[model samples]
Target: MRTSSLTGVTPVLTGSYTPDSGGDGPGIAALRLDPTTGHLSYDEVEPLPVSGASFLAAHPSLAVVYSTNETEAGTVSAVTRADDGTLSPLGDPMSSGGANPCHLTVHPGGEWLLTANYGSDTAPGTVAVHRLGADGGLLEPTDLVVHQGSGPVAGRQEGSHAHQVLVDPAGRFVLATDLGADAVFTYRLDTRTGTLERVAVNPMRAGSGPRHLAFSPDGDLVFSADELSSTVTCHRYDAATGVLTALSSVPATTAEDVANQPGGIVASPCGRFVWVTNRGADTVAAFRLAGNTLEPLGEVPAGGAWPRGLALVDGHLLVANQHSGSLAVLRVLDDGSLAQPHPPISAPSVVCALAL
Candidate 1:
């Protein structure tokens, strides 16, 4: 094991685009986080080479990271980070069993990795499961679950598009947000075998386009960011049976006239608030959370264009702006309001930010 101090600099791994890239950029870049000011600075290290590293997830207990190469022939790669914060490839990339794999997350037990494959024009969306080696290297996918059906919208929902896969806090179930299907699918995980068994398909309003979801700290509530309709939906979560009942749905953007696409949703650490990122409006909307309900707290400028990813680090809210090629740092005030601390930092086509 490598021993390192957490005093001066915190390592941050960012997935970005390359020069001649089509989908965003090319590789995964390294960054340093100032623990004091919550500011980020590029580390000037050579990024780990990948085709279209869009979304990233770190192993819970290892110095390894996984990323989805969002392309027609989707692949997931494993990279190990050295003690000095440099990254190197761990193994050859593995096919994600579908096209345009966009998001991935390591299981809470660190024994499996799950990916959401946003299918291409010719293929249907799927969710793939891969076993993890003892050291966190990704093994070949063990199972691929193809989603059927589509939403009400035309052109956008011609087929299923699974966007994200997340394991519930209790580890009893895995939930996937299908943007094209307009629903959240729940699965009972066979932990020992590293496979998934479909338990439920919770449907949302047609055309809601549920892209990403976040669960409350208590695991009693779940919130989804609806991409097509620019709405946020709160659901009552039943951890025992993995059922989600829609409680309320509200517009993600305060302004009615502005066209907005909601990208990411995250609940506060304390479970007092929920935050969602708006792409077209370039704002982050905050909501006060009550028992199975949400009251709009307001929205603030994202400090950059096209906020694609939002992560909570320490006590700060980090927004990865895809179009602006920067990451904005905002302080999470005590009352759950956001306050911009420093100007946005440079990061080209940043889609995911993982703090270590």
Candidate 2:
């Protein structure tokens, strides 16, 4: 698809990842989202020359956006958003020194930022911890840790791949999902020094491939999405020890068909429902939560293919469909199903969506 010159709105800033296909880096885009209509229109799009920018994480104060490059020479770029939504380079990008940095998290106090490096075909995956400057930039890496383990599935478990790293709502714990290891490694947050010391490590089922995790509003329960098994596991969280106990494993996918498995899992801000993406099935699964149990409420046809990332914004849910190259806006029904707000909006290789 040809790149479209963005027009028609005043964007507050442009965000882009480093990985663009065909030797072309992804475009840093300025966006204007209409709250009333749930419409997103682009204002500007500038090419980011950096390669492999996969995830863009905004700072706590919204002063900057950081991009992770899932490449051999792992790097993170700090970018400032202008009044017009055009991104300005902050300073020299820092090398993660690991490989394939997939996800990043900013400290609640805005003092530290962490990256989960997924590694590559030749490199073993690891986690890189860095401090954040007051001006919203990544401090040079002072600490890095490598993860090692293999899952039951030989094809998928050749080596460790750190899939995601998330901070608890209270900023007390940091969780990393190691796909190859089939484990969720937990750590205690040290804001003063920007370091991660192992608090606990919880193993998921043999071949579950724990991919990503999200916490409930109260921080009492944790939900992890298992990419390979197509299941979402619920765990009772121990805030003091950072230990997670299995409560129940819910099938995000339906039947034995691999097509029904989900890619992402997140709870509604109201804590009434949970959302997961069934990538191969091209649907978004919504479920109602009652204590520790979850009841399925049918699937929402994401209006696109391969729905990857979803965010609950205000009263609507925004979904980025990776294969259809589009973004969709949907409203949660009282019964927990999702309905389209309008036609699916277009974006090239859309992977994640974050509401500011």
Q: Which candidate number would show the highest lDDT if scored against the true structure?
A: 1
Residue pairs clashing, model 1: 17-25, 17-26, 18-25, 18-26
- In model 1, the runs with Cα more than 4 Å from the true position are 1-8, 19-26
lDDT accuracy of residue 355 in candidate 2: 52
Tell me how far candidate 1 lies from the true structure as C-alpha RMSD in angstroms. Answer: 1.7
Best by TM-score: 1
Number of backbone collisions per candidate: 4, 9
lDDT of 2 by residue, 172-218 (tens): 88889899998889888666666779888898898998888888898
Candidate lDDT (C-alpha), each: 0.86, 0.74
lDDT at position 346, candidate 1: 79
TM-score of each: 0.96, 0.90
Q: RMSD in Å for candidate 2, one decimal?
A: 4.1
Candidate 1, 76-114: lDDT as tens digits:
999988877778998899999899899999889899999
Runs in model 2 deviating more than 4 A are 1-25, 45-50, 255-261
